[model samples]
Target chain A: MSFREKIHWVTLVTMILAFGWYFLVYPWRIVASPAGVMATAGMLVPVTIAIIVAMTVATAFLAIRSPREVHAREDERDRNIHMRGTHFGYYPLVVGIWINIFLIFWGIGQAEQLNLMIATLVVAEIVRIGTQLYLYRRGY
Target chain B: MAKPPFTNDIRTLRFLAGEMTQGDLGDRVGVTRQTIAAIEQGKYSPSLEVAFRIARVFGKPLEAVFQWDDAGD
Candidate 1:
């Protein structure tokens, strides 16, 4: 596998794990004050930051280890595949965010959308990586 | 994997041209040896610039080095 492909796999798997943790196992520590605090997804903000930092470190290590599998430059075909994947990645969020607005008007709160938004972001990235892998394997 | 779009006699041509090694051809053309291998196996095709480069190294025309067939695409 090429360096970029290996990086793609590492980033792909890391993001999948991070996404699941952010939306699933991430602890949302509730804080209380005179203003009062409610138990919700607030804990995720810090946890997600930590997750991102950790994954970035891991990916950087992988990149440093294998310089050749990594592409210093892209050939024509690589750029073409990137464009296709970018289009597909953005489409999901357009539908997702618009529907989110619709739901808010129908009385669903912002908190309800938080998990969905995180999920969409994760799935979008997964789709992006999958598209890259697919294009690499299947041709541009 | 995509079948190579072009067929080449690079291996034979190289041999005919004073037994060129993959490294020699790659260095002459400014790409890595792996790329040369990929091109030879029909797993990858070089860019026009790279193709022309490979041809020029042997003092041949572009067509003499790389053959493109649309059927693969």
Candidate 2:
């Protein structure tokens, strides 16, 4: 595969893994007792750190495995794909962020309500990367 | 920026230049390799300056490297 495609694959996989780790910890909160919830939340930080470390290591391996292609500059098709994909996702990003800010303004209540901002950014990134992968596969 | 109604023979040029690499040419032309490939694919048109630079690398006139095509329906 092309370097662009490889980079896309690496990024997509890493993002998904991060999301997977997040869901594993956050969505299972009900299973835990009060102390368990605190313990789980505390464990989340380290799990997140581990996920990041894994992603970094995997990316490094992929990059090393194909230095020529990975380091090669992107070509027209890649740029076009990226441009079209970024523009496609930009609208959703703006809208998602605006809604998130509105949620904040409405005082969504929880101290962690502000955490929605991070979710918004994450979702936008996911959308952007997904769109890029789709466009690359579909062509510009 | 808008992509102009233009096309190029970069693929053919690449063949003729003793199989010059897209990356090497991109380095010389001051663009990302992806941009070069996009231009060659007719998906994205480059700036006039870039177009001229590309033409210069092949020692051809700008028109020789690129031209307009109205075949799009």
Candidate 3:
């Protein structure tokens, strides 16, 4: 696999694991309360930190293992795959935003809305990365 | 995925050119090794500039490297 493809795999697994933990252990019972928002904010700190650290470590390790490929620039195929991934990702982002807007007008709780937004972003990211990975595997 | 509408003889040319590695060819053509592999396998269609560059690397005319797959049509 290319260095970039390996990094994408790391990112995909990291996001899924980190967010999976967050959602599963989240205090969903308090999702309608102010404390729920605080909980979301509190939990996000560690999750963000974990993701950053994981990605940094993975990239460093991969670069060390393949010093030559580390300096390789993105080529035409990589750019094309990236554009296609972004094209697929945009759909979920737009849909999420529209849903969030409708929920706001419908009087959804702040924490609920916040969680929804977070889920939307997470899903969009997954779709984007997944699409890129697919293209990479397919040699596009 | 469906195959590209055209085909190429990169593998054969590479063999004739002292068994050039895909990585070497990719470096010469300013693309990735995987891109060259994909092009050889007909899984990807390279851009016009890239196609010309690949032909140039082999010292062959463009049509010698790649040919239209009239059978596909």
Q: How many residue pairs clash in all the candidates, one count each? A: 2, 9, 0
Please identify model 2 stretches exceeding 4 Å from their true place: A24-44, A69-94, A97-107, A111-115, A135-140, B1-4
Docking class of 1: acceptable
TM-score of each: 0.70, 0.72, 0.98
Error of 3 at A48 (Å): 0.3
**Given the true complex, what DockQ would model 2 score?**
0.27
On residues A77-102, what C-alpha lDDT tens digit does candidate 3 reach at each position? Answer: 99999999999999999999999999
Best by TM-score: 3
Worst 10 residues of 1 chain B by lDDT: B29-38
What DockQ results do all the predictions give, each relative to the true complex? 0.26, 0.27, 0.72
Better of 1 and 3 by DockQ: 3
lDDT, candidate 2, at B12: 87
Q: Write the per-residue lDDT of candidate 1 for residues B1-73, one digit (tens) a residue.
A: 6677678878988999999998789777776565677678776666788888888888898888777778766
lDDT of 3 at A90: 93
The candidate that wins on lDDT is 3
Native interface contact recovery, model 2: 0.18
Docking class of 2: acceptable
